[model samples]
Target: MKYPILCCISLLGSLTAFTSSATTCPEILSSKQRLLNSTENIELCEAFQGKTLLVVNTASQCGYTSQFEELEELYQTYKDKGFTVIGFPSNDFRQDRGSEEQSAKVCYLDYGVTFPMMARSSLTGSSANPVFTQIQSQAGVKPKWNFYKFLINKQGKVVATFPSSTSPVSSTLKNAIEQQL
Candidate 1:
């Protein structure tokens, strides 16, 4: 009887260890992405796991370009609470200046955006980046214009989407983000 009890305890310990070591990557964050103006790439799940994300498709020359300031403010406010904003420069609407360097300059030097900005990528049609593809599939919507935002919960689920016309400082957007956090 004593030997049987010891064997059962050992099996339970092994199961616990296996369970703890097996961390599953969420589907939405399972792809790799390169940062703006850099050759380095990072897995989204590895970098952003368990954090609420506000993913935006940006264009430097658009009428809504000034929204970057408001977006930065939103990021600064909730960043400490496990929230982050990610920008993806896209020329799907012919608004970008068409170079990674220019995009980087617009984001870093011009707007002072500290959040992660990805390299220029297609945001619509068959050439969309993997991340945007996932977002579209999960949220059932694609960005119709630059500055379109998708709010994702900590679980990697999209909770809300804001059009390019929606200000980052709008009460509706803020409330949605607060709920997720």
Candidate 2:
């Protein structure tokens, strides 16, 4: 009886996969990025297409570093509703020690971040990453410090930018997210 149930479950899983078709990622999200502490490259569009995103430029050593907990809470609450919090660790402000391994440890082990965090990259100026560059051009804002956040809608548009002092759990941010969803 147990073996039959297991077999049926496996068969159902296979059938579900067979019926589902893969979605093509949008051109805007086609840029390849690396996960923190790993060399594997991932296409951003394939991973987060059709999702409302809260993009944050984070630093492990910053004063507002505790926001990681709130960010994780936001992800836990709204993730099921097609919302995601994306983090990119940046050391441009000289707050971080410029170490990927340490950043990964703080994000994964210390803060217990379940949301996706990319490798360290510049968040402002000429050396900024493509994602940040596009966001700045569209929103007319640049990160003033570590922990700056940019909210992106499902259509890949920068809807809002929050400064370092804004908490991830703030009603203002939550309301903005709810509007998109």
Per-model TM-score, in order, reads 0.88, 0.84
In the range 15-89, model 2's lDDT, one tens digit per residue, is 787555233444446588999999988889878988999999989999999999999999999999999998999
* lDDT of candidates 1 onward, in order: 0.91, 0.88
Per-candidate clashes, comma-separated: 0, 0
| Distance from true location, Cα of 86 in model 2, Å | 0.6
The Cα error of candidate 2 at residue 138, in Å, is 0.3
Q: Which candidate number has the best lDDT?
A: 1
Q: Which sections of candidate 1 miss by over 4 Å?
A: 1-23
lDDT of 2: 0.88
Model 1 poorest ten-residue lDDT run:
18-27
How far off is residue 55 in model 1, in Å? Answer: 0.5
Q: What's the TM for model 2?
A: 0.84
